[model samples]
Target: MKETAYLLQAALISAWWVGLASNGVFFAAFQFDAIPSTAFWAFFAPDVILIAALSTVRAYKQNSAIELVILGAFAYASLYCVNATVLTASGYLPTGLMLLGLAYNGFLCFSDSAFRVSSTSMTWNAIKTLIQTVCIWTMALVIVPYVILDAFDTFALPSMDIWLIIGGLLFACFSLLGLTSAFFMVRDGAGTPLPLDQTNHLVVSGPYHYVRNPMAISGIGQGLAVAIIFQSVPLLIYTALGVLIWQLVVRPIEERDMTRRFGESYVQYCRHVSCWIPTFGRRGT
Candidate 1:
């Protein structure tokens, strides 16, 4: 029998597939213009091979190594393709698909293993987290912003040089905070920040002591910084939308998971720590 976690992952992948297809069709037919048919197929075509391979492994194999190999190849090709078309109108589609596809593929890999967070070595966890961070940053800060705001020549502020300097400074500071927090997670907690390989221990020694989610706080700040640097209203709104998603949707679920895993210890910590604002004098117990 599959673990509940793995089951949820599978369900989520299925739902994503259905939702994207249905919504695309609906919007195209009744509400708004849709992406080109070829662009849409380009996004989903590779997944056909991937799904078949992963299903094969699930049925007869003991591990997902072969599936992982194929995914790696596809992901590598996707990186090159992303670079080539990043400035194009429909480029966001493939870029977004790459992120979601890797996540779904990882879910399939977890299906084969009796999975648990922090089961891998700290080194592997750190490596995975770093790579994931770079990919997401490339998408959010570089690719998507250029495609959405820059390529289309969106409205930009006049005094952007000064704003750029300030935003760059803020980005560096928040990035340092995020990296430092990740290092603490790896060294002290024996895991990474990503859910697939989260810390085994409750990490409260560094930034976690001041806030329950320093990484999240840093991430939102970094997004805001990017928006400021770009001086694009659309980018600012995009970052704000992401903040809203994290706060309203992701935070509650994450807190529940932490409480479930860490029990009274987490509950007690939550009492002292704020989720968004960092406290200076007191630390979580």
Candidate 2:
């Protein structure tokens, strides 16, 4: 059953990547009339970076699920980017900085893959796969309503005159920082890799000092950045949903397993650190 699950995940992820590459090419083929909206540029362009990064890392070893997921994310981003091009032309796309951050992090995910010298125990990482399955569906389901409403916001809902651009830029900067921290933590061995996963270490340093789950926080930040850039109310709602799901549903399960495996040290670390949010105090000072 475990192997079956892994194979299924691998197949799904591979299909996703292939689709992403195909659509990415299609999206690139069409030229935008104006500066692509921040939303479009932020989410769409960096997908290649993510694909390359994940592929490079996976090449070091074979990780079916992780590979598939990285590919799947790129495909999803590609599709989103194609839509962003249309929205940008219509002048409805709201932000760019957030998109830039997304691209930057995507690059980091790839570049960080350059560092792995050996393989280690990634036992019981299947729990993460289960969490991911739930998380992805949750994200999609939560974002759908907003997408529908946003699709017709121009015709049905009144477009707010709020400064979404500023918010989007702020979001992008935050995401960039988060991604940088996450990359460094993994690349530098601040954290160990989850068993069986082909990424990096557990990453309990730098940004991880403040938040036990920097990557998850960064993911939420990225999602929020997208919402702010586009000013998509639905995406905003989904961002909130994503945060809650990650915090409430996902982290607890992973942490329990991690704590059991890592023992008292993991518990001690958890004492000083926050899960989704970063702590400001200096460590061991």
Q: How many backbone clashes does every candidate have? A: 0, 15
Total clashes for model 2? 15
lDDT of each: 0.65, 0.49
Task: Score candidate 1 by lDDT.
Answer: 0.65
RMSD of each: 8.6, 14.3
lDDT over C-alpha atoms for residue 158 of model 2 = 25
1-285 per-residue lDDT for model 2 (tens digits): 222222333343355446445765323323344654353446443544555445555555566665556646755655555565566553222212124324433432343243332233233233443455356535443344344344435224324445466656666776666556635544554333332243334456567667776656666766776666566665676577567544543455556556655678778888888765667874641
lDDT of 1 by residue, 128-194 (tens): 7788789877876777767556434463553648888999999999999988888888888888876
Q: Candidate 1: which pairs clash? A: none
Number of the top TM-score candidate:
1
Give per-residue lDDT, candidate 2, residue 66: 53
List candidate 2 stretches off by more than 4 Å. Answer: 1-162, 190-201
